[model samples]
Target: MKRTRVALALAPFVLLTGCGGLSGGPPSAAPGTNAPPTVPRTATVTVTVSPSTPSASASPGSPGESKLGPPTSTREVTVRRTTDNPPLVLGVRFAKHDGFDRVVIDLSGGRPGYSAHWVPKLVQDGSGDPIDAPGGAYLQVTVTPANAHGETGSPTWVGGPVFHAGLGNVRSVVKTGDFEAVVGVGIVLDHRAAFRILEQRDPQRLVVDVAH
Candidate 1:
């Protein structure tokens, strides 16, 4: 399909520019119910999750998947201008792509500023406690000017706390934090390799692809 999205170009896996932190998620619309039917989900594949992921975060992108460039080690982040509404994290999903594993963070309202980097291990945001994310390497992603819950303290995210991707490289994606306007996503990978992040409009979403 014809896709219209901006490429957050960087040195391979490195970010093109730096950004600030802390923001909430998308709208009040129920998860999956209002999300655009853009990315397709491919389910006929291998599954290695220990307990199995109970969230749509492990599902594949629908049809009309955008053409993101090859994953690179220098890639790091992508930023979206913040809005008064800030967005609500509608859902998180992942799928095994041709040469990498893909992670999609669905959002609403207006896309917000976000950043990510490689961390030695996963940890809770406020408490700083180490998270038991299954994998050999860890990637720390923070979505800011956003929220995973609505104003009434009701959760807007459509998944559980931690979900396993079980792709060739990505093992799982964990929600490490949701304090204030920031929502953290911890991705566990089998090994360290180049990856890139992009912001796609039309049912706004954040896409991360890690090399296999």
Candidate 2:
């Protein structure tokens, strides 16, 4: 536990007049009061994403959990740049929901910025343990329809959600013309409602409600 360069970058869709949820969340600061963590400085990128259809399914969470659902169309999303760190490029997005298919990641710029929490890796069928976080050095992932190209809609980004399936998960290294990013989503869904992080006054987001 000493790999904190902290940077998971992805920037493209920063309007925020008010965007509540899609599993892509970030907005809420109060209770214990939050917001005071933004650091970055490093660089690397060569990511890409193109979509249509391919794979989904991951069932593990009971040691530390994260689940959020509701998004039935949004494929092809990638962004990368990592190696020695701090240019902050690691954006990732994929959506589809009839049962499952959602992956969104964004860690931006650097100086010690962007730090998501969750760790445990290796599971593409080898069987078990899949969820990772490295620096906190930002993001790194690989998720497919689940069992290797199961679902089909055509377009193809090599299985839609797998982390390095064809490159493209939103990128970083800070040079999208200099800063202005937002992401605050914390989901855990499969039914059983109870996901909340609402702090209004001037902040609006972080909402995951699933239970049907």
Candidate 3:
């Protein structure tokens, strides 16, 4: 009876040791044995992309925007600005584009009035002499209330009288005249085609694009 009572007293201490350590952490690895490391569990995320469409307001071909086909005329293109201290013509330049030929006229002082149309022939202002510009058809771009000089009478046009564009449609461009308050730029093309005009600001310039 005395031995049985002693055994019962030590039973609680033996139960605690059989369970894990008191701190409740993972058990230590066996001595001198290779143990594997514990790696954290993670989730993999995936993302999908979608294509964007053109906006409703963006059309196929518009002024200043290029496209695959020829230009379409929006009625008769004309801008008339009458001023006494008119815009001065700086220079004339041209280049060949994807579906058209471009001609640019640089200007300053102010925005000037302009008239572009198919003319039978181009004539020199004041002198009335006929111009023998290259190409078969003539498209005359006339800027009114404009000058090729400033108040000091210094010529603003550095390279003029004529320029050979040599594009798909346009053959050349010529400064037919700079008389009175008007300045003329004649576009010589292989034949008449649909053309468009654009008026740009900031520095103020006139652009003409002929369909190829």
Candidate 4:
């Protein structure tokens, strides 16, 4: 009877093995049980920045108006001859600054008396030949008691009768003459405008500023 009972108990297990119900594997959750906890996913994001560009029609002192100055007028100016002090012409130079164009005449020995005036046309000092000054207006600059040649008759300032300045306002400088202990410089302007003359010491220089 014990062997008969043992066979009956082993019968259900043998039947479960035939049906593949006891395969060795991990246990699954019950129908109503919560699923295994899932790890949260993370995402990354990036951002970019761009620079701003300036536009046209922007007002002065604005971003787009950088590196530029306001326009100025060109009025007539003159400096009369005071004393006859002979100065030797050393060199000439030009510069563009602020609201004007500057022409500098370097001198040595002594500062000479000068006369600066606007003229309808530029003419040679002794020759009276019409100077081909390339500008709408002309400034006649005369330096007295000055010479382009030294006492030994050697040239101090020797160059062409016409010098191309090509500055802001002054276009050309014409060497009119070095006659009668006087030196003449003709300034050609792009347009007829206001101008001023200044004399500075310490090495002595004649400065001509024309409005741009």
Candidate 5:
């Protein structure tokens, strides 16, 4: 009976030692010490692109944007009848500007009626003779009630049928005819382009401007 009581006392001591060993024996660090270092995660990013806007000077019909202007007037333009206001052709001058070439016709008496058009080939006034105007394109300018002569039948405009203009766009100027109260002036261009005509008075001038 004494041996059985001693065995029961030792059994409780053995059970306590086994429970301590199962709890990792002893702690390597204190409780609530330095926590595990937090690892940072990389974030994803997104980007977007948009088209740029045009400036205020960006016009559709600007000279820098287009190489050529609008088409010139195709139909005939006449100021007055051929019999009215006979004017004498005094001189012819040529000028070169930024993007155009100009031809100025000086008159003595008054402004005369004229017809200007693009022609496939420029011919003489009276005789059906072909004028060898030096250019890739030709403009036939005819002024009515006008003459390149004075009252005594002297040649006022002292130039030939073919005159070398050598301007920006105008290659040459040809006097196709001056017959029967009509004066003909041919403009030869380096290339086909748009042109405009203007009439100025006081000294009575006819102006032709061709785009380069």
Candidate 6:
């Protein structure tokens, strides 16, 4: 009876004492006091510039001029048909704009000698004038935040072609194709540009300028 009583008293002590060394060895060093909350990382962007070239000399389409001022009003652009067989253009998408806007084309199937030049009045200016870029084999898009389909601000041209600070919204120009080529202008101001050519299965995507 005495032994049983002694065991009962020591049993609690032993169990409590062993908790620290039981299933595992001695407890690990108290985890370094909780670390301070971590901070999120942010991306840093860089800007580079190149010499300015004659806006008219590149190709030809819209008149070369500054349309940076505020828009007097708003207007929509009309869809035009191309001569390519099987209709190379599947769909044309444009970004939302307050001053100048952009139209993007989704190709159904790429053609060798695909080229883009401004035709007739697709849209109008803020003053309600018919917009035209009639020149050369290529179409010259008069890039201004307010004039280009109600899009606001200038384009940041980047990548190998060139970036001219004098031209506010203009960013980069890219040409793609082995036998035949097409020129593309990257209007995305937030991204930087990169280009790559793939063989066989992978689709060859020519990124004019990506957001930085």
lDDT of each: 0.68, 0.25, 0.65, 0.61, 0.64, 0.22
- Per-residue alpha-carbon lDDT of candidate 6 for residues 1-212, written as tens digits (9 for 90 to 100): 35544434432111110111112222234467766434322111121212231111112232221222222211111112122322122222333233333334333222211212223322332343432322222222221111111123222221322222211222322211111112233232222111111111122111111111
* Lowest lDDT 10-residue stretch of candidate 6: 13-22
In model 3, what lDDT does residue 190 have?
A: 92
Q: Which stretches of candidate 4 lie over 4 Å from their true place?
A: 1-85
TM-score of 3: 0.65
Backbone clash pairs for candidate 3 read none
List model 4 lDDT by residue over 1-212, tens digit each. Answer: 45544434442211111001112222446679798523222111121212232111222333221232322323233333333346789867777777767778888855455666678899988888898776888878777768889888887878868989887778888888889888888889888655555555565777666667
Model 5 agreement with the true structure over 12-107: per-residue lDDT tens digits: 111110111112222235467876433221111121212232112212333321233323422323334333347789878887866878788888
In model 1, where do residues sit more than 4 Å from their true spots? 1-65, 78-81
1-212 in candidate 1: lDDT tens per residue?
A: 99999989663322221211111111244576875544211111122222232212211342234454346453345443345667889889999988878899999875466777778999898999988777888888888788999889988885656797789899999998889899999999999876766556666788777779
**1 versus 3: better TM-score goes to:** 1
The candidate, 2 or 6, that scores higher on lDDT is 2
- What C-alpha root-mean-square deviation, in Å, does candidate 1 show against the real structure? 17.2
Q: In terms of TM-score, which candidate is strongest? A: 1
Ranking of candidates on lDDT, top first: 1, 3, 5, 4, 2, 6
Where does model 5 exceed 4 Å of error?
Answer: 1-76, 82-84
**4 or 6, which is superior by TM-score?**
4
Error of 1 at 10 (Å): 18
TM-score (C-alpha, index-matched) for candidate 6 = 0.18
All candidates' TM-scores?
0.67, 0.18, 0.65, 0.61, 0.62, 0.18
True-structure RMSD, every candidate: 17.2, 20.1, 32.6, 39.5, 40.1, 26.9
Best by lDDT: 1
